[model samples]
Target: MIEKKITLVPIGDIDDSLLEYISQSIKTTFNLNTHLIPCQDLIGCVPEPVFGGRYNSTTLLKQFHECLPGKIFKLVAITDLDLYSPIFSCFFGEAQLGGCCALISLHRLGQEYYGLVEDKALFLSRCEKEVIHEISHLFGLLHCSDNNCIMYPSNNIIDTDVKSSSFCPSCNSLIERALV
Candidate 1:
């Protein structure tokens, strides 16, 4: 497998520190080169959440193709205007251009209920987990049963926080196999 880079497309005005943490986490964990492609227009492309916005993997990928060739494995992360389940929290898809992927963030990633202050560190951790979760999907890994693994689907913020930012042994083994 030719080690490919994961390119991040920043959709809106996401915090700079959050973006830095995300890029660094992926690179450090996977040893994959990562890049951030800034485009203010991405905000217009970002749709409202499913309950509140109409965005899907297909539409988002196409918009990215117009701006980037897909072979490089691109990923887009957007800090949306509203919060939703982690089901709608992140998305990734193969680009028609080549061995590429695109992803978007629905919200900043945290428990925002009950007036609890947003924990920047937790948000960073969630973002790291989600980014790896989606990127692993591109490499053909499924949701794992391990609750502490990043590949586990997070139905709520509690699940999100409970999950670790790295995959469990089984999932990690699968990733190695797929990369082989």
Candidate 2:
């Protein structure tokens, strides 16, 4: 099997278990060697939701690029923002790069959003789905019409809760093909 290295760069302090689940999911699903790196610049990006927030993902990614030369990585910025605020989760989409690089956000992964479901199992499942969905975009998979699929567009917490943690058959096939 052709091995790919997937890196997760944290934008801020987040649950370590969530990070571990991400690494495991990437390895099992995509057969990749995944690494999680905590970036101080990313962590310091916590900005107030009102007015212009300090979190600028594009700027952060550009800064990360300077540190790792020619190393393709996925920088995920996780924050405990009240995503339900009139202010939407400015969480950006995954960007496809030449050397397998991209970025994702964990705005909706907050516990209280899902009815304060602080259970780590539930949190990890939600996190894995979001991370997988974003990573799939880097491989050219668009949003899926299946509501039960992870690739489905989740405009709110209800949508995310309704979706399953696993990809549907079609999406699974697409990912398998990409790996090949």
Q: RMSD (Cα, Å) of candidate 2?
A: 4.4
Q: Residues 1-180, candidate 2: write the lDDT tens digits.
A: 433577676655677877777888888777777766666533444344443553444444454555553444444444443222233343533444333445556655657545675666666776777777777877777789999998887776567779987789998898788767
Residue-wise C-alpha lDDT for candidate 1, range 1-180, written one tens digit per residue = 534677777666777777778788877777777777676534445454475463565555556666564354545545454433333443322222223554646453654633678776776777777777777777777878999998887766677789888889998998777655
> TM-score for every candidate vs. truth?
0.75, 0.72
Residue 13 of model 1, lDDT score: 72
Any runs in candidate 1 off by more than 4 Å, and if so which?
1-3, 40-54, 65-67, 81-99, 106-108
Provide the lDDT at 9 for model 1: 71
- Candidate 2 clash pair list: 11-42
What CA root-mean-square deviation does each model show from the true structure?
Answer: 4.3, 4.4
Candidate with best lDDT: 1
Scored by lDDT, model 1 comes in at 0.63
